[model samples]
Target: MAYTLHNLPAKLEASKMATLGYARVSTQDQHLTGQLEALKAAGAETIYREKISGARADRPQLAKLMAALQPGDTVIVTKLDRLGRSTRELLDLIQRIGDARASFRSLGDPLWDTSSSQGRLLSTLLAAIAEFERDLIRERTGDGRKRAMADGIKFGRKPKLSDFQRAEAIKRRAAGETLGAIAKSYAVDISTISRLRA
Candidate 1:
């Protein structure tokens, strides 16, 4: 079903429910000025700013904003990526917000507002599509791996120790040699010798 901002119900009251905004730039070279201005114009009372990699989920400013949210509050982001790096992460954050009896919206994507019933439905549909996409990618990856294996293409890291070295290490261990001594003789870490047992 199609949903638009205009057709949607009246926006939540900012007085009763705070409309907080989040602005993030993936690198220190980027600036948050534009996002801040847009968010302020969109009626965001308070804003959280962060300059960090989006791939990192442990954003300090985002953590503080999430913790500060209360029931009836709405979180606003200049873009969806400002909230999360990927669709799965976005959905996870939205789920947490919903659980807190709060809502989320992105100025970049008007269709993604959790403040209304239609928006909530859209959110569910988007999340399902994201999950389906991930599953398809995983299936294709597995198929590719199987095909490569059939073609005699090896996968995974090359063995750190040769077969002869491995066999010698086993013999040394059986001969009551210390693990550190075996590792030193082979010029490899102790973990490498331990893995030979498997």
Candidate 2:
């Protein structure tokens, strides 16, 4: 069924299952007319459009479309890249639609549609590949971290006090100076001085 922006809410309220569309453009200069027309031609009753990078996870319109999903609803996009840049992110979005008892379809990439058996099989394979990619990234990151640590590279926040200042703070504490006094002298927190072992 064809729907315009004016009657979209009324149509949505009347139908239990709706064909929802999402169209995205990475930059303000990009045109959404093509995607919008394609989605409308594909029988999308309500189209959500956003001008934002697919790499960003905090897309407001996409979030709204996801929230508006109902059981047996179908979410259609012109292309897979229009939905997300990364395979993991696309799979995750599709999984969320499935969790909501809805399905996804890509007009440009027919094999990515989740409403068919072939598409489901391809999604399963893609999910496996995404998992493998994540594992490789984790392994590489862990190895790099280990190498950096072995080379004396420190991670996390820098120490607030230098070694000399720390030693002096401990000595001052042992000599009966108040933590507040030591902390004020070093321009550090009182908790920092209190944690120093004498």
Cα lDDT of all candidates, in order? 0.84, 0.87
How much lDDT does candidate 2 score? 0.87
Error of 1 at 67 (Å): 0.7
Point out where model 2 deviates above 4 Å. 1-16
Model 2 collision count = 0
Query: C-alpha displacement of 84 in model 1, angstroms?
Result: 2.7
lDDT of 1 by residue, 1-198 (tens): 111122223454423677778888889899888998898888777788888898885898888888878899889988888898887888999999999999999999998889888889988998899989989999999999999999999999998899898999999999999999999987999999987873
Q: Pick the candidate with the highest TM-score.
A: 2
lDDT of 1 at 135: 97
Across residues 86-128, which tens digit of lDDT does each residue of candidate 2 receive? Answer: 8778889899998998999999997878889888899899899
Q: Estimate each model's TM-score.
A: 0.70, 0.84
